[model samples]
Target: MAQVLFLGGLGRSGTTLVERLLGELPGICALGEVVHLWQRDLRDDERCGCGSRFSGCTFWQRVGERAFGGWANVDVDRVHTLRDGVERTRHIPRLASAAQPAAQVREYASYYSRVYAAAAEVSGAKLVVDSSKHSALAHVLRAAGDIDLRVVHVVRDARGVAYSWTKRVARPETDGADEMTRYSPGRSALLWNAHNAAFGLLARRGVPVRRIRYEEFLADPRAAIIRLADFAGLAPRPEDLEFLRPGYADLRVGHSAAGNPMRFTVGRLPLRHDDAWMRALPPAQRRLVGAMCGPMLRAYGYPLNPQEAR
Candidate 1:
């Protein structure tokens, strides 16, 4: 069985950075957004974090060989079908319960178990980090019965999330030719609510979940990361975290599966809490996001009013 530190949250909520930070730890291998692995890497042949095409990346090629004797042995379409049938947002309820779906769901979960275990085996890391950011996928993976899955639920203020969605950020993994997807303020808020709510239900189901607000994590990166490392079952010495020096972190290029373009960044990167949304987001739109997020905004420790948040 593989122990996976699963980062579950909505996009742009800072899971990618956390994944990167965890990857730098001595015995952890970060595999970004494994939820998108089938389509993004195997089907599309996108670039891996190592800056090589998926087919050309030696790391994933070995992972494929180790996991299923080879990627060729797996039925991509059947795996997709099984995943689609049992990993939808609607299936979270049943997937998290004792009466979790059998049959295809179990079969689907077996694939993830193999994938994670192979990642650990190939990298020779004590644990693997996956920033999949989907609660439904977390539930599906938990059904495997052979994985030690730990969840880190990242939350950001909905207003910031709405502002981020409105931005036209480029998708560098797609050769900077395509931009990332965008969503309306209402839709972003609703997703923020729905995603965070699922994690709440996930925690009650006895999963080892550590909820970290994006704002708080940035405010104290050093302490925050150490706490997160501990929760994920790693006991790091002070020297193990020398990557965090003052306000910047020393990063390295990784062979991630799929994620934000930031995953490719290396060397030193500045860290800060992105509060631009407070001023840049239109007042009306900010209020709309707040209203849409409703109680979840407060439930996650976000102040309802814009002023109080600051």
Candidate 2:
């Protein structure tokens, strides 16, 4: 069975960077946010992690040929419709059943199984990393039983995530303002609690999960990656730890569908901690996120200071 290490968490929580670092390991091939492949990349023709457009990427071209006898044969709209309906918060729990396969789930899993298996074949890596950060998608993969799945739930401070969503970070591939995402503090915090809570439910339902806080990761990425490697059942080598250094990484293109513009990042990848929100974010907004997050922030070890909440 192909080994799939799925990253489940809220967006802008360092999931992309973690995937990039882990992708650099010897036995791991990181495929950025394949959950968005059909809708974003295939339909919209977004830029790939490498500098090429998704459809133009030669690596993904081969993958399409391998997985679905070329992308032309696949129905993108149907895939998305099924995804929105079945692979969602309300529909995922039903996937726990082994006897009766939900037709949509079965079909979706079949599509992804081919993708993951082909990634393994093409990349020659034993582990395929999918940093989709979608709990429902992760649950579908787990319940499908076609592959061996493990989860890494990446989290960051809700305040930081809120601040991040507020910024208009551009996609290097696009000169226009179409692809950017923005979220208010209240929405960011509420989703953060919901996503984490969903992953918690998944864990309780017997999915193997490993939680990693982004702050702790930045403090010592080497240790963090090693812990992750161990959880994925990979033997960590000394060189596998080298990519965590505070410098550029020799990144290559993968058949990733969508994610941060960091996919376009090559060469030096600065592994510094980002705490700009602590200073730049308005105090009121910080407090807003803190209040919306409520006990969840404390549960994640982020104490809501009265001063910050003010």
Candidate 3:
């Protein structure tokens, strides 16, 4: 059976870096945000982590051929639509419910299992890191009986997450198309709660889950990697972390489908906390983020106020 490290949490919570770190480990293959593989990578023609177009990459081509015979028969638009409609936050309750109809759910999950099985076979690695960052999708993938899935729920301070989303970071994958995302602090806070809460429910429902705080991991990545490795049933040598540098690891290119432009980071990974929000974010937004996410923040051991967060 193929094992999967399914990354479930809000984006910008350090999942990409974590995924890259895990991918660099021996016997682990990081298939970047496989959720975005169909639409962003295949249909939108985004760049893979190795800097090749999706269809142009030999590794992905092989995976496709092995998983689904060929890419021509896979309808990107249709698959993307089906995935989004069935696995967004709004659809979580139904998908997780035992009483709900699941004909389509089974179909989508079957697609994921085949892809994951093919990835494991092609990479010759026992572990696959999928940083899709959606709890609902994580639920679907875990429901697939054939794949042994472990969830890594990454969390950051809600205010930091909200601040990160407010910035206009360019999507390097899209070239000159001006791809970027911005969300209001209120929206980010609410979604953060919803996503994390859903992941918690999944854990309570008996899925193997290990929650990693971004700040904690940044403080001691080696220990963090070891703990995560143990959770995922892998053994790491001292040299498995040899890629670690002062700030960032010397990460290699992966066949990631979609994620932050950091997916393309080749050399040094600066292990710096993004606290610029403390100085840059307005008071109202900070308060809004805290207020919207206060209960969950307290539950997750974060200070109620951003000013109090270290």
Task: Compare the candidates by lDDT and give the number of the best one.
Answer: 1
Give the per-residue lDDT of model 2 (tens digit) for 1-310: 7899999899999999889888888889888999988877778887888768878888888888888889888899888887887788666557544447677777887788888988888888999999999878887776566789889999898998999999988776564556578998888888898888888877877789998999888888888888999999998888666655554456655545678888767767777778888888899998888888868888878768834422
Q: TM-score, each model? A: 0.98, 0.92, 0.96
1 against 2, candidate with superior lDDT: 1
Off by over 4 Å in 1: 98-100
Q: Per-residue lDDT for 13-82 in model 3, tens only?
A: 8899889888889999899888878777667777899999988998888988998998777877667667
lDDT value for candidate 1? 0.89
Clashes by residue pair, model 3 = 247-271, 248-269
Question: Alpha carbon lDDT of residue 215, candidate 1?
Answer: 94
Question: TM-score: which candidate is best?
Answer: 1
Please list the residue runs of candidate 3 whose C-alpha ends up more than 4 Å from where it truly belongs after superposition: 99-101
Residue-level lDDT for 54 in candidate 2: 79
TM-score of candidate 1 on Cα atoms, chains taken together: 0.98
Give each model's whole-structure lDDT: 0.89, 0.82, 0.85
lDDT of candidate 3 at residue 27, scale 0 to 100:
90
User: In candidate 1, what residue range of length 10 has the lowest lDDT sum?
Assistant: 93-102
Residues 13-97 of candidate 1 have per-residue lDDT tens digits of 9999889988998999999999889998989989999889889999999999999999888889998999889888888888877
User: What are the C-alpha RMSDs, in order, of all predicted structures?
Assistant: 1.1, 2.4, 1.5
